[model samples]
Target chain A: MAHLTYFNGRGRGEVIRMMLAAAKIPFTETFLTERQPFEKLIQDGLLPFKQVPLLKIDDMELVQTGAIVRYVAKKGGMYGADDKEATMIDMYYEASRDFYSKFLPVLFMKTEEQAVKDAKAAGEDKYFPALEKRLKETGSGYLLGTSLTMADVGFLEVLLLCVEFGGDDFLDDHSDVKQYYQRLVATPLMAEFLKSPFRKRKNDEQYIKEVKRVLNRE
Target chain B: MAHLTYFNGRGRGEVIRMMLAAAKIPFTETFLTERQPFEKLIQDGLLPFKQVPLLKIDDMELVQTGAIVRYVAKKGGMYGADDKEATMIDMYYEASRDFYSKFLPVLFMKTEEQAVKDAKAAGEDKYFPALEKRLKETGSGYLLGTSLTMADVGFLEVLLLCVEFGGDDFLDDHSDVKQYYQRLVATPLMAEFLKSPFRKRKNDEQYIKEVKRVLNRE
Candidate 1:
């Protein structure tokens, strides 16, 4: 049995949870609800790299969200079919991360309006178009092929997060991305997971409040 | 034959070059010397993510520095020895990337001094100690056991960059990390590559100039 630990947020842990659910793998999620215990875990040297989303299999504990997701994807057989597909999957995963890197910092910025504006612009102008083109070229099923892979799940998580930040119109110009996102959510396991209370438990209130404070000042 | 393309810089392409060299594999490094041609390549659809460090194997082109390094590492047989080692390698790779994430943005900030100070502090307080502990426990001479892997290569790149930013006395407190740095540089292929003109070809003039400007202001 795998024991996965993270904060009570969907920030980095959502994809891991989705991958486990998609693979029908059973794992216990230990959510750190506050900073005190998290600091204690760090002091105890239980948290490798002083971070969460650490995955423990028996005795081995692994850190780095990207590493954890890729490891889980490999174990779940959702990595990719071959070298080419894997390369594509890797490329897409990095693209999603690149997308997030643009906007995530904005939540803590003093110039939240300008930062949010830039993030939205980049998302609409660059990321969405690239995603739309890729999905169209590959067909509407998944990021790579007819079968689901980690890229699709990871990409969807990024899209959902950006959409939450950018609002519904985020995908209006890119129908393919919108449709592809719908396809991912409608997948049997994901459909069930999306409706679960787990999906609504995004503990990004601190970040959200900060962004709101900056925006209100603006 | 593999063809790697990037600026004259070791910014993101050095690891790929090092991996190929360490594995005794042959590859052609295509350095983009000018902005015009590089922009043209992006416009020509030559760059998938509109970024360089694109690895072209035969006809297929792959982008993203992380993806390229991992792929080249895989091809060069430097990924890892087993599944567990691979996970450890992955974890370390992401940790190295996380280290970069903290400092890289500092280069572009108005509060560059404070940012660099924080980055240097974290490098000393968090990253360096963790690395020293890992090195002592593994006793592998590398991050993994007995043989070199991508984690060492990637982590070395991060260390070199942070050391560059953190100044000469940065490693004074962490003798183990200092020794490890010397050890990696002494690896035959890495030693040769380090002394080569290739290592000095860092052509990120725009970024370097900007960082210098902000530091001068302080």
Candidate 2:
């Protein structure tokens, strides 16, 4: 069985959860809601880097988000058909992930300044258009190749959260991305997971407090 | 032919260069000394996300440092012998890389304050101790397995840089890591590469200025 330990929110852990859901893999979770328990886990040598989103599977405890994600993706056969294709998948995944990181702060803090908001919103066109260009260039109905891979999964995962942060019309400038996002969601696995109970909620003020409590920013 | 394009300094490009060198693979390089030429390359659509350390190999223009490193590791037969081993390699590599990132700002500007200096130095004990624990647990002389892999290579790479930044005695607290570092360096492949002209220089004031110019920090 796969078990996940993180906070009550979906910061770094959601993507791993989504990958599990999409693969129809059943997993349990433990939420570390306070600093003491988090410190205890670290003290117990459970976390490799004293960070969370730790997954215990195959009789091994895994930390590092990138490593856990790769293990899950490869296990689900979502890496790619071959090495060259896998390289492209990784490139797409990394690019999408880099773009996703810009919006991560939204989960913990609310920015009211228009300048900060504008600067954050500015990343959409700056990064997504290149993704738009790739979708148009590939014409394969996938990011790099025909079959669905972690690249597509990662891209769709980030796009959904970007929409959550940027609103329904977030992809207004990215027609191809919008279309691709829809196409990915309609896949049977994703369609099921989207409606499943494991789907985490978008952040709210209450949840932000919850996350802040876990972050324990003094 | 394997071709690399980056700025004159090592920065992000040196690891890929080392991996190639360790495998006795030869490659040519193109250096971009100015921002306009970089933007021009982006305009030409050679870069996936308008970044450097672009490697043209196997007829693919690869970007993303993590992805490029993965490809090179796999091709050089240094990834590991199997899936579980590769996962461990990924973990060690990502952890070491994360630790390396905290020191990257040293390349762009001078950090003179003792507090910042103290904080940077603090990371060595926080991180390398965990790595030392891993080394002791494995007892393979390598990081994860009995044979040398990217895990060892990446750890050594970061340790070398950390030593350059921190000093020769940086690993005095990490006897296992210190011993492992020496072991990796003494390997025939790494020993030769260490003496080769390809070994990049550490960041100096002039190199920092060069990097700042390429970064175009105004």
Candidate 3:
């Protein structure tokens, strides 16, 4: 049995959870709150990188989120079978990484104003347009060749974060990106997941709220 | 025949070049100076991401340095064939990415003091230890299990970058990482490649020199 160790809500662990749910894979969701098992795991070999979202597959433990997601995606048949589609899937996955790399550091900042400013300049100005263009180029609506791969799931998670942290109007300026976000949210599995009780802004809500307040003040 | 497009130096393109040279794969190295064909390519496709180090197979273009490296690694048989080895390879590759994510941004900073401070805090403090731990855990001396894989090559590239940008004394603080770098550099194929005229940091000399200057500044 595969065991996933993460915090209460979906953050780095969301894509893996969603993939498992969609594939009907039975696994233990070990939420590491500030409590018993969490504290124990932190002290033990579980927290190898001293980070959460670690996947325990039987005996082997995997740490990197990308590796874990790809492992799960491969098991779920969400990673494309053909080489071309797989390459395309990889392209989208890396592109999402590129997008996140631009804005992720901002979230670590103490000031909400600085975070919003950085997001606007980097996320809105640079990443969104590039993503929009790539989406259009794909021509199949999906980020990759045709089917919903892990790339789609990864992008959906990022888009969810954008709405939750960057606000409802996060996609207001980029129509294509906004449309893509809407399409993603409307997907049946995604919609259900979004409505599920498990869907909350894990450890990030305070930062999101603070950023929103700063934007209002500005 | 595969075609690699990048500037004259071994910036992101070096590993692919080395892999091809080791495999004796016939590929055209299209150096993009302020030249004609490069200008035509710029006007034609614009590199999808507007980045160098793109690989073109027949008509299709593949972007992203990691993606390109993986694709080439597969072609060169540097990535493992079996599932378990592949997973190990994936782990090392992911670790290399994690290491770079911490240090690459610091290299791009304008101020020398700020760059060194950030590198010390993030690069030396956070990344090096993580890499060292992984190297020790592998127990194979090479990054992955038993045999040398693309992960080792990828990591060697990162370590080489540290030495190039941070100077020879860069990895002096971490004995294991230093040993791993030396071991990688001693590989006959890698050693031969290093002796090649193409291995000189001529094209990227200015960037490296600036980085070294910043790193060495008290």
Best by lDDT: 2
Clashing residue pairs found in predicted model 1:
none
Residues A34-65, model 3: lDDT tens digits: 44564466567565445567888847788777
> Cα RMSD to native, each candidate?
4.8, 2.7, 6.2
Model 2 lDDT, residue A6, Cα: 87
Per-residue lDDT for B123-209 in model 3, tens only? 565456666877778887876666567788777777776776678988898898888889889988788878875464633446555
Error of 1 at A144 (Å): 1.6
Report the CAPRI category for model 3. acceptable
> Candidate 3: which stretches are off by over 4 Å?
A8-11, A22-26, A31-43, A109-139, A165-176, A202-218, B8-11, B15-26, B31-43, B109-140, B164-177, B200-218
Query: How many angstroms is residue A21 displaced in model 3 relative to the true structure, after the best TM-score fit?
Result: 4.0
Where is model 2 chain A poorest over a 10-residue stretch in terms of lDDT? A112-121
Which of the numbered candidates is closest to the native, going by highest DockQ? 2
Q: For residues A103-134, write the lDDT of model 2, one tens digit per residue.
A: 65665455634433653454553567677788
Instruction: Specify the highest-TM-score model's number.
Output: 2
* lDDT scores in order: 0.73, 0.77, 0.68
